[model samples]
Every structure is written in C-alpha cells, then in structure tokens.
Target: MAYRGRFAPSPSGPLHAGSLVAALASWLDARAHGGAWLVRIEDVDRPRNVPGADEEILRQLAACGLVPDRPPTWQSQREALYQAALDRLVREGKAYPCACSRRDIALALFAQGRERTRHGELVYPGTCRAGLHGQEARAWRLRVPEGVVPWTDRRVGVHLQNVAEEVGDFVLKRADGLFAYQLAVVVDDADQGITHVVRGEDLVDNTPRQILLQRALGVPTPQYLHAPLVLGPNGEKLSKQNGAAAVEVAQPAAALAAAARVLGITVDPRVAVPELLAQAVRAWGARYP
Candidate 1:
C-alpha cells in the first residue's frame, strides 16, 4: 500500500512548540516515504475549541512549508461516518450502552475498596454491561476482549498492552452524545487511508485503545512512530493545558529551525524558511525513511 500519514491536532488552542514537533515529524515522515500527508482538525470537543484556532493552525503550518497534500478533514464534520461505525459495532454486539457516570464509578470503586489504577484512570467496573434496567443510556462503550495488543513503534521499539485488563470497556460516545476521540480517530484514519501515524509519545498509551477499535471495526491498524516530547521548564509535557507558549509565526525560519532541532534535524541559521524546511526534509528522509 502507498504510505499515508497525518497530523491531527485538536483546535482547542494554537499549535504550540510540542504540537509543532509532532506536525513536523508527521510531515517529514510522509515526505521521506514519498507518501501523501494530510491534516485533520480534531474539533469534536466543541466545548473546548478556541474560536479561529483551526484557521490559525493551518496558517502556521503553511508558514513552515508543511502544507497538507489535500484539503483538511474536520472531525466535527465527520460525525455521520463515526455514527455509522458505532452503529455497526452495536449491531455486532461489540459495543453496548453505558449509563455509569464518573461519580457512580468512583462510588463503586470506593465501596469495593479498590484503588485507582497506576495510570490514574478509573477502570469502569462494567456496571451497565449486562443491562441498564430502566435507566437511559448516557453513552456507549466498546467491549474489550482479554488479550494483549502488541505493536512495534518505529521510534520506541516493541510495546504491549492488554486492552481488557488495562483499559476495560472504553466509551465510544460521550454522555453529551459526542463521538469519542478514540472512535472518531479510528474511523477517520481508516477513511483517510492513513498507513502510518507519527505523533508525540504522550499518545503512545492511547495507541492500544485505537488498535482495539480498529480491530473491532475491521479496519487496518496503521504503523506507529512516537516522537520524544517537549517538556516545560518544570519538566512537564508542554501542552495548551499547561499554558505553553504558541509557536511564533513572525519569525517563521527561526521557529521552524527550532522545531527541526527538537527532532534532531539541524539547519543553518542563515537559511530562509523554505530552504530550512528543504534541508530538514532531506535530513528527515535520511534518518527516518
């Protein structure tokens, strides 16, 4: 199959340095394999979206010469497709309605005297799996089977996770009736024919969840590459939630070079944006291709 990769960013905020690194790596990897690179705005979480952030992100990517191979896809506009997949999963008995709220889950765990998992995620105790009785469904969750999902990462080597044991049954749609990121991304990647996924290491844990969804939905799981993270001065992951500064587009060359350096690509400070990106592309092709 021809290689296809993407940079899917949530429009909750502008592209910060950390997100820019993921974008650059995705773009460079696509270029290295002589494949198509696409962009997708993950705006499904409408409540958190910053007005005009999507357009600003595109402008910044353009300024860095990391243009998409085609027009971008927006998750907010792809709800029908996600719903179709969820419906299929429901029909196949792979997913079921969930009525448990966060508080309900906490109380159940507390009553059982069970501590939260090391990952700090509240493992759903399958409260509504058998039946919801007369309660209305607040969300839908996929049933994870007991087995280890194993995949090798291009950057980090082999990895493994038992979806059922670790993730339990995960939600496919939220209580607000919004398609969950796990479901939306799986459907979108398969629809876009994304063959490789190059992203930040922060998402590495989510990979197994996505893989399980892909299998349950009968879609191919893409190859994975997780780039090193950019940390804040306090050694936390640089993210919008942490108030990381947005990448400065005023000095495109400098910003692009800084991002390139983070990915281990060096460009002459004197080089303009275009040339700097070209050099970085060549380096990336040699290193990653």
Candidate 2:
C-alpha cells in the first residue's frame, strides 16, 4: 500500500469543470505523495452511459496533463468481480433480496407521513429486508446493522453517520440488476489496493456507505479527502446532470489553472501544461503534506 490513489468517474458525459477539479486534486495528491495514480471508468450502469464519453474523458484528462499510471479500467468489463462480491454478501446473509420498488417505498413513507429522512432520500423502511413480502426478488440490499461509522477526512474533518438509521438497509444490487455504486466502488478499491481517495465533497455522504461495505467485505478502508466542489454560477454543484458546460480541452493549461484555483493552488499562466502541473504538484505537496 504505497499511497495508491484513484479517480473514478462515471461516463455519463465529458469532463465538466467541476469534474476536472476532482481529477486534478486526485492526480496532484497522488503525485505529491509519490503514489501510483489510477483511473477507473464507472460505466457499470450502461443505460445512463453516454456513447463516446469514456474516450473523451480520457482525452480530456490527458490534455490537462493528468495521465493514469496504467490504461484505465472499465467497470462494465468487471462484472465477474462485482458478481463475486455480491454473491459473497448474499451467501454470508449480510445482504438479502429486495422487491420493493421506489413507488412502494415512497407510498409506504407517505402512509406514515414521513417524506424524507434526516440524511435525505426516502429512507427505505426495510420493507423487503425480511422476505420480499411474497413477491419476486427484484434486487439485493445490504443488511446495515445499527452503529455509528466515524472517520476523519483529511480535508473535511470528522464525519459520523449511522448507516442503519440514516439510510437503512441500502441496495447492493439495483432492481434493474446493476450493482450499486457503493458495492462496486468498495470492491474495486480493495481489489486495486487503493490507499487514498481524493474527490469532491459532494461525495462525502457516499463514504459511510462505502466504508460499511468495505467492513462487511473484509477490505481495508482508504484515507479520504473530500475537496471543495466547483459550483456553477447558480451556486449548485456543477454536474453533468445539472447541464454544466464541458471544460475547454483546447486550452489545457487554462483548464488546469482553473481547477488549481478551485483547489487553492496558484499557477503561472505563462507556463506550459507540464510546467504548470509540476508547479501545482509541488504546491499541493506543501499544502497537503
């Protein structure tokens, strides 16, 4: 575990400015720590994946002088790995079949007049945790036990979440049969021996669920640093779903500079991409180390 890190991005769209910030931060931190930096395309959910988005993302990352140590891996091609993990969870009784649809959960909450939980999203009321109520199992869910998952983030400070109470037994495999991100990411990180995760703060909540999955799967949890997100003009997190504009790949240094600024690193505009990245990496090492 020689400071291995990764930047896993979904292939829903091209790299937007916000996503570039996440990329740069992950890359810089790896370089700063003298670690192996890897890239993984999270395209397991094929329905939402945009055609050509994966190639374009790789091209964009290279343009910004952020190259993966090895050819990037794709989640879609790693089905067997995910299936093995899911099967293990099932065999151990740590996970169970779930048949409740979104509407069923929503209606159940509405019946109880409970719209949202404190952590948001219709807190699944464990409707199918027992036995799917005589219906066919449509998905699989992790049996989150009651406890507090506490961890100190390198950047965001301490975070504690009661996964059982806040999120209830969460889905491991979706009703559509796609493995959930929580399971896929945990399995991938452990398999890759990832020791550090540097990404945007928007993913802060996802950490606890991932940590729980790692514990159940007997995998090591990585150090995390949730950096500040790049917000849109409207103050919303710039996201592909939010219609955030793509980064200007024609000007690699400019895009890198913008992302560096978001990470609080100052760069010389006159420098070329390589020099710019070298300077930024040094700055990141000083700041984070």
Candidate 3:
C-alpha cells in the first residue's frame, strides 16, 4: 500500500503546543515518505466539543503550513458508516449488547476479587457476554479474544497486550448513543486508507484496542509511530484538560520549530513556515528512515 498518514485532532479546543507536536510529527512522517497527509476532526464525542474549535484547529494547521492533501473529514458527519460497522459486528456474534453501568462493573469486579487497573479502569467482567438477562441494553461491546496481541511500533519497537485479560470486552458504542473512539477511529482509518498513524505517546495504549477492532472488522491495520509527548510544567502530559494554552500561530515558524525540538529535530526558526517545514522534513527523513 502507498504511504498515507493522518493527524486526527479532537475539537475540544484549539491546537496547543502538545497537539502541535503530534500534528508536526505526522506531517513530517508523511512528507518524509513522499506520502499523502490527511486531517480528520475527531469531534465524535459531542459533549466535549467546543463550537468552532474545529475551524480554529484548521486555521492553526494552515498557519503552520501543515495543510492536508485532501479536504478534512469530520467524524460527526459519518454516523452511518459507524452504525453499519456496529451492525455488522453484532450480526457476526463478535459484539454483544451490555447493560452494565460503571457501578455494575465495579460491583462485579469487586465480587470477583478483581480491582481496577493502574489506569483506574475496571477490567470489565463480561457480565453480559452470555446474555443481558432481564436487563435492557445500554451499550455495545466487542468480544475480545484471549492470548497476547503483539504488534510493532516504528519508534517504540515491540509490544504485547492481552485485551481479554487487561481490557476485557471494550465498548464499541457507548451508553450515550455515540460510537466509542476505538470503533470510530478504526473504521475511519480503514475507510480513509490510512496506511500509517503518527501520533503522541499517550495514545500508545489505545493501539491494541484499535488493532482488535480492525481485525474484527476485517480491515487492514496501519503502521504506527508514537511521537514523544510534550509535557507540562507540572511534568504531566500537556493536554487541554490540563490547561495547556493554545499555540500562537502568528509566529508559525517559531511554533513549528519548538514542536520539532520535542521530536528531536532542529530547524532554523528564523525561516518562514514553509521553509521551516521543508527543513524539518529533510531532518525527519534522515532520522525516521
């Protein structure tokens, strides 16, 4: 397959320094391989989305000379595709409806002498795998298989996760009548023909669930390269929820150069955005190749 990569950003807020790092890394990866780079607005989580945030994100990227090769895609507008995928999974017996609320899951895990993972997520106890009993369905979950799921990351090398043990049957569709990120992202990447995924290290844990979804949906899995995360002053991952400020795109070259440094690339910040990106791309190709 041809090299095709994407930078999918949620519209919860404008692009910050941390988000810029991800965007720049994905753009450089695509350009380094002489591939097409695309953008997708991950606004599927409706409640968190800020009005006009998507437009502002696009503006930030444009100011930094990281334009997508094609018109950007919006996840909110692709409900039909996600519904079709969920329906197929339900039909194949690879997915089932669950009536377990967060409390129900906690109680069940407690009864089974199990505790939440270090990440504070309860490894769901498959309470509804057999049947929902008399309970009404509130969500849909994939029936993850046993054994280790092994995959290689371009930057991080090998990794293995047993989804059945670690994550259990994760949600495909949430109780709020929205498709989960794992499901929507998998479907979109397959639909968009994304052959490569370059994002921040924080999302590395999500790769296993996405890989499981791709297999269940019979779609091709993309190569992954998780760029280093940009940390806040408090030493935590910089994020919108953590009050990371929006990047100043007025000085696009400086913004891009700062983000490039996080990825271990040095470029002349005095140059224009286009020239700075060109220099970064050459440096990226040398490093990533």
The candidate maximizing lDDT is 3
In order, what lDDT does every prediction score?
0.91, 0.91, 0.95
240: Cα error in model 2, Å:
1.4
TM-score (C-alpha) between model 1 and the true structure: 0.97
Model 1: pairs clashing at backbone N, Cα or C within 3 Å: none
TM-score of 2: 0.97
Could you tell me the TM-score of candidate 3? 0.99
* Clash count list over all predictions: 0, 0, 0
TM-score of each: 0.97, 0.97, 0.99
lDDT of 3 by residue, 154-205 (tens): 9999999988999999999999999999999999999999999999999998
Give one digit per residue, the lDDT tens place, for model 1 in 1-289: 9999999999988999999999999998998898999999999989999999999999999988889999998999999999999999999999999888988888987888865773778888788889899999999999988889999999899999987777789999999988899999999999999999999999999999999899999999999999989999899899999998989988888887888888988987577877787788899988876
